[model samples]
Target: MRVLLLDNRDSFTRNLEHLLVAAAGADVTISAHPQAADVAAQRWDLVVISPGPGRPCDHPGYGPWIDGGTPLLGVCLGMQILNEHFGGTTEPLPGCVHGRAEPVEFLGRTLRVARYHSLHAATVGSGLEVLARTRSGIVMALRHTERPLLGFQFHPESFLTEDGGSLVHSALCLLGLR
Candidate 1:
């Protein structure tokens, strides 16, 4: 599979790239967060929005990609971006979470995922379904009801996440890439 991994100036992007390859056998291309127009000009089987600092509003220009019919996987801030693009709201968590591991029920299993975020989706967007959440009710995973779009609030590439590769494989399966 050909994947375009959009870098949001985050540190974990390289790890994500590696996981995409090892888990999904994807030919991944890393690009510093490109404009929607730039992304629209390319041919990609899948597009990955990497986790990054700041709120979704801080990093704009992803609407076209989200609505253009191409499959997309968003991580952390990227997931917030997806929510915001689809008319959801993002707000600060009561207490910011960073570099912590938490258990979430996903795909019929409890997965310990690494979370690093200060903000979260206050309301999910139209046509999107909540797939998983933390014990405290923080949204952990989501997918569009009709579109091939998925988002993860936690970092699957983080070493802290046990069976991280399986999460990547699960994402591909959800996106219909497997």
Candidate 2:
């Protein structure tokens, strides 16, 4: 599958790329500076938004892909971007999890995932469904109601996440590429 990896200059970007290629059998393209229009001009089966350091609101270039009908998977800051684009809100967490494994309820099943973000989704807007959350009630994952878009608050590409491959595979399945 042809996958576009919109990198936000996160340190784990290379690892994420390797995982996508090795595990998902995807032809991955890395873009350091992604613009919505430029991205829309190309053909991509899936778009994976990599985790970054700043607020997703700060970079508005990704707004074009939110409703473009292609499957999208957002990680960490990418999740916040998806949330904000869909009218949701984000806030600073009371406690930050740096390379810590926490139990998260995902689609009714609990799994340990690596957490690294300082901000979490505070409120999800209309047409979006919460798929996972931490024990303390922080939103850990979400999916679009009417679109094939998913977001994860945790870093699934990191080695810290034990089921990271499975999570990524699930997203590939969502795109019907598996």
Candidate 3:
């Protein structure tokens, strides 16, 4: 499958691109906010939103690209995008929610990964489901109600996260990539 990787000022876009390429055997195209239009001009089967130091609301035009029915993978700030897409607010997780954990207590038990963010959005819209979260109630994982949209609040590309590689692979699996 072909996927478009959104560049959010984070190198993880390239990192995930490689990881996703090796893991899912898919062609990934990387693009930044300025080049978003060009990326949209192309035909992509899915979109992967990588973590950025910025907020989704900051990029008003980007909402439509993400809200579209195409499958999506939201990571870090990308996760917040999913929440915002579903009408949620993103504030700090009360503290530095970026670190390593054995397994965060969500619906089940998701391995702790690097979460580098201070701003979190609180959802006010609908069409989103919480797939995972920390004990602090910061929604970490979410999905779109209508299409294939998955959001994760952690960086699955950091070497500290051994399972991150597999986590992204699982996202592709959900999209039937494997």
Candidate 4:
């Protein structure tokens, strides 16, 4: 599958690229400073928004992708960007969570996944559906109601997380590429 991987210039982008290519045989293109117009000009089977170090609202390039029909996956700060662009709100965590496992309820199962984010989505817009949340009720995952967009606050590409491949595979499954 042809995939557009938006690199937010984070430490995890390369790892994500490697994992997607190996796990799903995706033809991935990495773009660090992605402009919305430049992104809209490309054709991709799937688009991945990688983790970054700051608030999603700080970036002006993410708003346009919300209306595009292409399947999109947002990881860490990318998830936050999706949330914020859809009229949701994000708040700083009481403490930074890195290299830790947290219980996230997904698809009727509680899975312990690696956590590496300090911001949590407090509320989502009407167009989005919450797919998972932490034990403390922090939004951990979300999907657009009528679109092929998905978001995960956790870093599924991190080797620290057990069964991280499952997350990657699930994304491909959502895109019907698995």
Best-fitting candidate, measured by TM-score?
1
List the global CA lDDT of all models.
0.91, 0.83, 0.72, 0.82
Per-residue lDDT tens digits of candidate 1, residues 72-134?
999999899999888999999988999999889999999899999999999999989999999
Of the candidates numbered 3 and 4, which has the greater TM-score value? 4
lDDT of 3 at 127: 80
lDDT of 1: 0.91
Best by lDDT: 1
What's the count of clashing pairs in each model shown?
A: 0, 0, 14, 0
Ranking by lDDT: 1, 2, 4, 3
lDDT tens readout by residue for model 4, 1-178: 8888888879999989998888788899898766846756989988899998888866668666656777889998888888888888888888878889876767666667889988788789669998888778788889888778889898888877667777888777765666
lDDT of 2 by residue, 1-178 (tens): 8899998989988888988887788899898877845655899999988898978777678877777788999889888999998889988887777888877777556778888988889999678898887767888888887788999898888887877778888777655666
Preferred candidate (lDDT higher): 1 or 3: 1
TM-score of each: 0.96, 0.93, 0.85, 0.91
Residue by residue across 1-178, what tens digits does model 3's lDDT show? 8888887788667778887887778788887772456777777887888787767777555567765667788888887877776668776556665556445654454576666677765563488777776666666677766678778776777776757667876777665556
Candidates 2 and 3 compared by lDDT, better number: 2
Residue 71's lDDT in candidate 4: 85
lDDT of 3: 0.72
Candidate 4 whole-model C-alpha lDDT, 0 to 1: 0.82
For model 2, the superposed segments whose C-alpha errors exceed 4 Å read: 36-39
Off by over 4 Å in 4: 36-40, 176-178
Q: Is candidate 1 or candidate 4 better by lDDT?
A: 1
